[model samples]
Target: MDPVRRTPVVVTSALLTLLLTVLIVNLIQPVDAARAERTTAAGASSTSTVSVRRFPKAHHPSKSASSSSATKNQTKQQKPDPAATSAHPVDWLKPSQQVDYPDPAAHPGLSLEVSLQDQRVYVRDGSELLYTMYASTGMDDSTPRGSFRIQNERGDHFYNPREGMGARYYTSFLNHGVFLFHSVPTDSKGGYIKEEADMLGIRPGSHGCIRLTVPDARWIMQSVPTGTPVLVK
Candidate 1:
């Protein structure tokens, strides 16, 4: 009788042990799956951080680069245009109203050069140009082209009855009184002729003299010494 009862109790104990084993296995499997999910999520986050650090934002120009470009543009704008300056020349018709007299004592090599083509006179010390003056030479090549010494003949005023014209501040350079450096044409009453004065330095209008401005003629009459060499070309 005791053997049969012991067998039933043993069977019940075996069933209880099997149920507890299954419950523990189910709990451990869920915990391990959750841990694996957390590890995978952490690894993905680290990979995303590395990707962000590897590549930076797009590049932008610095302030110094922009300023250098601006400076280059300004330099180009300030440069002078040679063509523009050459197109516009000085107007010589207007009176200079200013004269810088030369000191023959300080400049012993000073001489005069006349340019018939340019209608200009250059006061030169050797090769150095000291001053420039506007002038009108004789028409039809009446004035001689050669080196001439300034003669001792000079006058304050004169008139030619045959030519019906006259001039002032005359200084003879050739033929004593034939070829002279004088002021613009004047009337018998000593008034300057406007039409002839306007032609000064522009074209040849004189009969046989080199015509100059009033101030220029006066300066030559008073300042230039005798025996000075004058070259006409």
Candidate 2:
């Protein structure tokens, strides 16, 4: 072959090889870029899943904790007041003196009902309550619990020397002159005993007698007739 022909052929072959290498490099660059994009997307998705698993929503109190708090508030509201159970006196007078009594003659068929639990007397006409009176029945259930009738025995004042206590306006209800309705306890000198009188309508303190205020005993001694029904319990 001639030298010129060989040089042209070699040059053509070199140009063809360089063109093929450029085409292969272009195709491989696009495929590598696509693979890199897919790897970046997968890494971002895994990072997002980890972030969601690490942190949770804010905390809240459980149902039992809320219920316990509500129960404590209700218990505090339901507690009772200590002062409401007892009576308070007005000024210097006894608790019984603050009460108003009804006239005995106006209400027909009057009877007496005594409550040991409340330490009170209810004056009733049939089923109607006409008046309420503060009374001290007896200590340790000494006052008899049953129905009885008032006797014809009564007095302005009397003292039992053995017991060293006395009362005014005594009206016999049981055992003739043994158990009576009378004013609060008095000394031998006829002055009121402060300790026993203060407990009227609050607790039982009498010695098997129905103890009333001065005016209440006086009214009963004067107005209430003999054989009046009295129920004590």
User: What is candidate 1's CA lDDT for residue 102?
Assistant: 77
Q: After superposition, how far is residue 141 of candidate 2 from its true place, in Å?
A: 3.1
Off by over 4 Å in 1: 1-99
The number of the candidate with the highest TM-score is 2
- CA lDDT of 223 in candidate 2? 87
Structural similarity to truth (TM-score) of each candidate: 0.60, 0.68
User: Which portions of model 2 show Cα errors greater than 4 Å?
Assistant: 1-58, 62-71, 82-99
Q: Write the per-residue lDDT of candidate 1 for residues 80-182, one digit (tens) a residue.
A: 8786664222233333346566777778887888889878778788998877878889899987898998888999999998888899899999999998988
Model 1 whole-model lDDT (C-alpha atoms): 0.82
Which is the leading candidate under lDDT? Answer: 2
RMSD (Cα, Å) for all candidates, in order, is 7.7, 5.4
Q: Model 2: per-residue lDDT, tens digit, 1-233? A: 79978998999999999999999999999999999999999999999888877655322345667888999999987887677754764121332444566666777779989999988888889999877788888999999999999899999999999999999999999999999999988999999888888777778889899998787788789888898899997
